[model samples]
Target: MGKVYIVGAGPGDPDLITVKGLKCIEKADVILYDRLVNKELLSYAKSEADLIYCGKLPNYHTMKQETINTFLIKYAKKGKVVTRLKGGDPFVFGRGGEEAEALAKQSIPFEIIPGISAGIAAPAYAGIPVTHRDASASFAIVTGHRKEDAEEEVKWENLAKGVDTLAVYMGVSNLPYICEQLIKYGKEKSTPAAIIERGTTSMQRTVTGTLGTIVEVAKKEQIQNPSMIVIGEVVRFREKIHWFEKQAENAYPVSGVL
Candidate 1:
């Protein structure tokens, strides 16, 4: 029986894919990719490989998780080298663990290849370090989205008052709620925060403001998902660095803090 490979395709930049992850794409007989994965990477696949789209948007799924698992099992059982390519590290909110568990239960041989998660890469490309020697020494990655009306399990108190920096994923839709929680739970309303939209790509856009004003800034900027929210003093560094935006300016020439 052929084995299954669950691989990370990195954030958005096609070049950021790890060597091993790229190899999986090249050798796979069937590739199931997510919405956020860079389409450019598909060029590396073998001539006859079958590419499947399994992308999901907020509250909408093109392919159900169970269907994906069934495909992995069915293809592997047929002796096909199957690759499940997801955006970002498969284990880091990419549902890699669930897929792995399904494979394990079926006794299917599989390998997991990790990729660069946007939590760090997004901020880096935006010139904001998640952790700095003086401004920040501790960092936390938290999910910005949750089931509708779901109980809030995230420790906002600790995250607000304890963590030195926070890299929030998929939190743009709930920006107001996130800001209010942090401030209500002990974070300073004046704390600096920034959003890096479509980060690590030529289309990257960044907006910076205090916790109290970021919601308005995001609204005005029309920043959308596939974005990262970086909070803490580390965000202050963007004014000094922000090299990617500068590079983008040379190529795309955007206006005003994007």
Candidate 2:
């Protein structure tokens, strides 16, 4: 049986892909890629490599998770080197763990390749460090999307009181709810916050405000998903060191602070 490599394609910028991840793409016989993956990486694949699209939108799935698992097994059973390329780290909200479990159940040979997640990368590119010596000492990566049927709610209380920095993913749509939870759980309403949209790419945009004002700022900017919501004092650094946006020729104009 051939081996399977679950690879992270990084956050948008093709150059950010790891050397090992690039090698897997270069040698794979079959590649299943997600929507958020930069298409430019596909150029590294062998000419005969089979490419399949498995991108999913919010509330819409182009390819079901079960179907993806089936394809991985099918390709590996055929003795073809299979590469599953996903955006960011496969384990971070990428549903890569579920895929790994499926492979494990079947005793399929597989390897996990971690990639740079947007949570950290986005904030950094925006010149907002998730953790800093003076501004922050604790950090947390959270999902903005929560299932209504989830057995337990996210521990917003701890996050508000314990964490110094929060990098929230897939949260543009639920911005108001997130802000409400944080404030309701002891977080200061004036806590600094910022949204880095389409971070790390040429099209990145950044907007900043307090927890109580960011919702309106985001709405005014028409920020969309694939954004990182950063909450902490570190966000104040963006004005001084936001180097990427200054260098990005195509970056969107910065929105005014509230």
Candidate 3:
């Protein structure tokens, strides 16, 4: 039986992929990649490699998780090296854990190759540090996408009172709800917040505001999914250290809420 490699493709930048992740792509006989993965990275795959698209959209799935696991097992049993390339870290909201569990049940041989998650990379590219020496000392990565009835799954009170910083993924659609929860749980309405869209890529854009006005700012700016929502005092540092946007030829001016 051949081995399987679950690799994180990093955020949106092709260059952000780890060296080991790249090597997995180069050596794989079959590659299943996700939607958020940078297509440019596929260039490294061997010419004879079989490329498969497993991209998924918000509220839509192009390929089901069961099918993906089946494919991995099918390829590996055929003695073909398989690479499951996903955006950000495989285990961080990428469903890599489920895939690993599936493989484990079947006693498949596989390696986990971690990639930089957007939670940290996106904020850094936006010049918003997840943790700051003076402004922040605690950090949390949250999934903003939740079922209507599962709102209580996240500990809003602890996040508001205990955490110093929060990086929310897939949150653009639920911005208002997120802000409301934080505020309702003791977070200051004036707490700084910023959203980085398509972060780490050339098309990245950042919008800043306070918890009280971020939802409105997001609506006016028309920010969409695949964006990172950062909340903390560290957001204030963006103005002084905002470097990546400076390099983008078409970077938008940072919109701030008064």
Candidate 4:
């Protein structure tokens, strides 16, 4: 049976890809890549290898979980080297855990290649650290949507009180609702918030405002899905610590979405 490699492509930057992941793709017989992986990164794949799109959009899934699991197992039975490439870190909110479990069920040999997670990368691009001395000591990364419980059941109240830094994935569409709940549940409405769109890419955008006004700012700016919402005092440091400014100076205004 074939060995499977779950690799991370990093955020949107091709250069952000790790040497290990890149080497794997270059020798892969088949590559199953995520939707957010930069298309240019695929050029490293073997010319004769097959490329399959298993990308998922926010609030939507392109392939059923069971189908993907079954497909991986079925392909491995053929003794080919299969690579499942994912965007950002494979284990961080990427469902790579489920994929690993599937591989174990069949006793298939697999390796996990780690990459930078968008959660950490996005905030860094916006000049906000997830942890800070006065700003925050702890942080939590969570999805805005969950099927098993009411939105309230996801424990926004406790998180609102417990975490100094909150990074919500799949949160753009639910921003207003989530923000309102946080404020209502005891988080400071005046707390600084920022959205980092297409982080680590030249087209990346950093928008900052207060929690009380971020939803309005987002609406005014038309920031859409696949974006991250950061809430904490650290966001206030953005203006002073903006290092991506150097990169921004060199970044041309690329035409197209970020």
- Model 4: pairs clashing at backbone N, Cα or C within 3 Å: none
Q: In candidate 4, what are the lDDT values of residues 1-258, reduced to their tens digit?
A: 899999998988799899999998998898888888999989999899999998898768898778888878888899889989999999988889999999998999999999988888888877889999887899998787745567564598888888899998888888888898889888888999999888878777878898899999999999976788899888988988878856677665566775
Tell me the tens digit of each residue's lDDT in model 2 across 158-187.
888899999998888989988998999888
TM-score of model 3 (CA atoms):
0.95
Report the C-alpha lDDT of model 3 over 91-175, residue by residue, as the tens digit: 9999999999999888899999999999999999999989989999999999887565554635777888899999999989989
The local lDDT score (0 to 100) that residue 31 gets in candidate 4 is: 89
Residues 1-258 of candidate 1: C-alpha lDDT, one tens digit per residue:
989999999999999999999999999999999999999999999999999999999779999999999999999999999999999999999999999999999999999999999999999999999989989989999998755543573577678888999999989999999999899988888999999999898888999999999999999999998899999999999889889889877876667875
* Cα displacement (Å) at residue 189, model 1: 1.0
lDDT for model 2 comes to 0.91
Evaluated at residue 232, the lDDT of candidate 4 is: 89
lDDT of 1 at 108: 97
Candidate 1 has an lDDT of 0.93
Worst 10 residues of 4 by lDDT: 145-154
What clash pairs does model 2 have?
none
**Per-model TM-score on C-alpha atoms:** 0.95, 0.94, 0.95, 0.93
